[model samples]
Target: MKTLINITLLSFAMLFMSMLNAQDTVKKKNGEVLKVVVKEINDSQIKYYHFDDPNQVLFTLDRMTITEIKFAYGKEYKEEESIMTDDYFTEDQNMVLSLSMSSMLFDAIIISFDKAIDPKSGFQITGKLLGIGFGPSFENWYNRSGFDLEVGYKLKFSGLKKKKWEYRPNHLLSGRYIMPSVGFTTYSEDRSSSQIKKNLIHLGLKFGNLKIIQKLIIVDYYTGFAYFGGSKKRTLNSYGSDVDFEYNDINAGDLLGSGNFAVTFGFKVGLAFGQYGEQKEKLKRRK
Candidate 1:
């Protein structure tokens, strides 16, 4: 009777062990069910260990290719795919809008638009309106007004390959960049009874970077110098049938510099939204 009772207990233990060993199943989207033990689950992938292997080698599969995880005890877990990727230079995130006040911070507004040509380069255009309606009361400020249009291309250094460096691929507008641009500007000075207008052509170099938050907010910091050539125009009459003007200090010279160079610097804060992010979400849902 003692030996028979011991045999019965051993049989019950084996049955319980077999039941525990087959406690989980990984179901693929194709309707195949894998009877494996699940070790972990995340938005990107699922990790598990097989039942027959003695070493318990782990395997991970992308959640997009999976359907659901069904446990032996009747619990089920679904997979979710995250839409954001490291590549941000695609259509939705590639375009940027920025505004910077650079002309002595007194009475100027600069608006810029940028488009990523690729992962490592981009193109930008800016419009600067100077002295619209603000008054310069500060000691070192000048009552100057102007309009400028500029075009430039940006080259990024972080896009270069490095040794043992691990970074997300195609991260545009988020690193250090150097840009060379050409622009034209018309500046005016208000005198007691007349206005002095100057037309300038400038070449510039800009160095800057942009930081993004939650894929929405963008913070831009930049500085540069422009070599310019200009010609002066004196308006003889403000408003009259006999309006007159005089041209002075006019010169046709090299594009580099014939007039002077000025420092350009400013900060810009703006928002970012696009269809690329939405497309990723749709793809994730469809998969």
Candidate 2:
């Protein structure tokens, strides 16, 4: 009876040890739960082995897809804690509507809409209405009638750290991006004695940073150059003498003339909507 009791005690101890070495639980963002032996976790991926497999073949998963992990040793890892260190985009919050703050100073109302085609790329369209804002009245130039249309394709760079802080992913559209754009401007400027109609086309490349504030406001600043062409020269007098009239400032020339190279820069403020905005609202409600 003493030997039998010793054997029973040893069996119970072995069973308890086995329970302590059970599999880890991995919960995915899609609500799938995985039973596995986690092997390694890096910045972008998680490596694991199936718990039921005797051979212990390895598998890999994107770290972003995982929401939580409960280890057998009573340790828990939550994905939310590391979200700010990574870059990701949700399907719902992928669009932005912005107004050009700099354009208003030029007596133009420039409104732009941006649509994200994917996490790394998107497109933008801007509509410009000239001579309608509370800008400086160009008294020398009257009857200013024209519109400008611009379209651009944006390519975003990932894995770049923010200058002000650590790798924090707060906004749906926050990063450094390069954009190639095409624009068309057509307008008639009526001077006191001479009226000139100008039509111009330009090809431009821009480098910009977009930042989101308070999960609702967007601030975008960009600087670039545009090659303007396809514009007729301004005839200064009724004699119809074509002269190359240019502005000393590059930005002014870029916005007002053609057949030359000009510098472009602007600031825009706007709103962010969709999935991220919805999430922000939900968090506010919870608070």
Q: What local distance difference test score does each model get?
A: 0.65, 0.73
- Please give, for residues 83-152, the per-residue lDDT of candidate 2 as tens digits: 3331354434667999888866666788889976655678999888876656664432566667888899
TM-scores, each model vs. reference: 0.56, 0.64
- Ten contiguous residues minimizing lDDT sum, candidate 1: 249-258
Summing lDDT over every window of 10 consecutive residues in candidate 2, give the lowest-scoring window: 248-257
Candidate with the greatest TM-score versus the true structure: 2
lDDT of 2 at 100: 87
What global local distance difference test value does model 1 have?
Answer: 0.65
lDDT of 1 by residue, 197-282 (tens): 77877778888887777667788788877777666666545553222343332111112223375666667777665544554566
Determine the C-alpha RMSD for candidate 2 after optimal superposition of all C-alphas: 9.9
